[model samples]
Target: MSAYEFPALAIQDWLRVFCYDSYCADAMTSGLTNSKDTVLRWQLAVDTLYRLIASDLLHIPTLKADDLSAQKAAALDYIKSLAHHNPFSSDIEETSHWYLWDISATDRCHRLIEAYGIRDIPQGELSQGLVAALHNLFAENRVAWSDQPLIAVSADS
Candidate 1:
């Protein structure tokens, strides 16, 4: 497979394994009190990352060689797009909104796009870097989730 095809397929496989499979669902929610809420947060994080990767792929062809400004613009564009959302009123919507906001604020995602725009990187190296960055992104999100209060408290109490 070509460089593009490899990352696309790898991302699809990751989505299947983490978002679609029952095993990951169980693992992600296992020690949490608000299991359902936790699951939703995890899914949203994964989905957001997937969207970022897809957007980066789309911008690759437009990237100009040796043009730092174009590369930075692509990265910034990815961050900007991820931050867009309707004003949220409900709990789930609010959760997703902030979740995405937190992700976009991270420098790692920005660097990933910038690195992807580089012209001289070997295809194999690029693919590896993409895969590694994605894995780190997911791991970091998972860690952030784990640091939150696992048990949901009722306001009525």
Candidate 2:
């Protein structure tokens, strides 16, 4: 692990590596790649996040009341926006908005949506679904402050 690498990374990229490894033999990947600034890119690229979770390596942070309230407000507004507006047929368009269209139906995504009350980012790459996705995958400041103790573990986001 390079000194430049942090122990944490964005959840989407982390999950991407997990999926890549889950389906492909040898995951057909280095299982060790991440965005340049992203730590644990190299070693984690090969390992599935499911195993990491099972082994107690990855920890999802729980949001506080304030955070949850904000997320809920955002979500309600987003749902209102989505009313009668389908990505498939809606006039509004954004390319990155729908990457997880199929994956959104997964239990994991549903868990996030339920957990975070996520709606939309309202800023960079903000889409209601992506907001839900981020709720599931992304880490907050608490992730670093998590009570879980990690030692002798290879760094990955």
Candidate 3:
């Protein structure tokens, strides 16, 4: 499926899973808590990378070739548009705002953008709740990936 075809709920999962805390802090600081615009900006950042990775013709080894030039141009346009949101700008001062970069880098999920020097997202402050959520997501998902013995296993024990 194309990256644009990626489900909204899945995007939301990535947002919450990857960068919820920083977004919350920014929202609270800017007095835009629960703002739709803030959420949309975050989604745009996510979608740009998702699109690049999902592009059928844009493999990494041949990035210098002209095969996916049109697709690459479109993706770069998305990044440029995403930069207007302040948090996703390439400027060092705005690095903290690059939540998508932080999210993907922290999760070790995708680094193609960083590898290409497209953006730099410095680590941002994370709240205790966000830390806990990240831990839980990792722990639970890891258990689901294997048939290894699970400690404290019980539905309601």
Candidate 4:
């Protein structure tokens, strides 16, 4: 499979679980809060988690509160490790490149989220479903993070 194939399929599967799971569906429509800002924050949090997974910086078998917290920290540490390897000698160039990369990563992350129908979710229930769907995805797939390039397999294989 191509690099995008596996993650795309995995994400789709995750979405299916999120949409169909009773708890998740309830959370999505529960009218828990009317605050748009709160909803946005929840969305951002979900996006961050998904970005880490997509970037292969995080791997876990579930997104229970404690496990999610621990893995998020680990992923942040991994990011810090990468930052320590600044390629440019000049501070200005490094800062510029960092922002550029951030912009690119954000764009990609948003596209992935939107393409998966995640962006269409009602604001109030976003937080309620966040952990559950991710937990289901992790439990079902037990995704493993790797920096290795994904190789394409021949159709016959």
Predictions in order: lDDT: 0.36, 0.31, 0.34, 0.35
TM-score (all chains, Cα) for each model: 0.24, 0.26, 0.21, 0.25
Q: Pick the candidate with the highest lDDT.
A: 1
Candidate structures ordered by lDDT, highest first: 1, 4, 3, 2
lDDT of 4 by residue, 27-106 (tens): 22112223444333233223333444545323333323366557555544433333332322256643242232121123
Candidate 1 residue-wise lDDT, 1-157, digit = tens:
2111223333433333332222211122222122345344343433444344334421223334468457646544533333333212255653343332212112433455457543344332335555666655546534222333222222222
What lDDT tens digits, residue by residue, belong to model 2 across residues 1-157?
A: 4432332334433343333233211221232343453223322322223223322323222212367446434433332232222223233452122221111123454454345433322212323454344434425312232233222122121
Tell me the number of clashing residue pairs for each predicted model: 0, 8, 0, 0
- By TM-score, the better pick of 2 and 4 is 2
Report the Cα lDDT for candidate 4.
Answer: 0.35
Off by over 4 Å in 2: 1-9, 12-40, 47-109, 122-157
The worst-scoring run of ten residues by lDDT in candidate 2 lies at 95-104
Q: 77, model 4: CA deviation in Å? A: 12
RMSD values for the candidates in order, in angstroms, are 13.6, 17.3, 18.3, 17.8
Clash pairs of candidate 3? none
- Judged by TM-score, which candidate is best? 2
Full-model lDDT, candidate 2 = 0.31
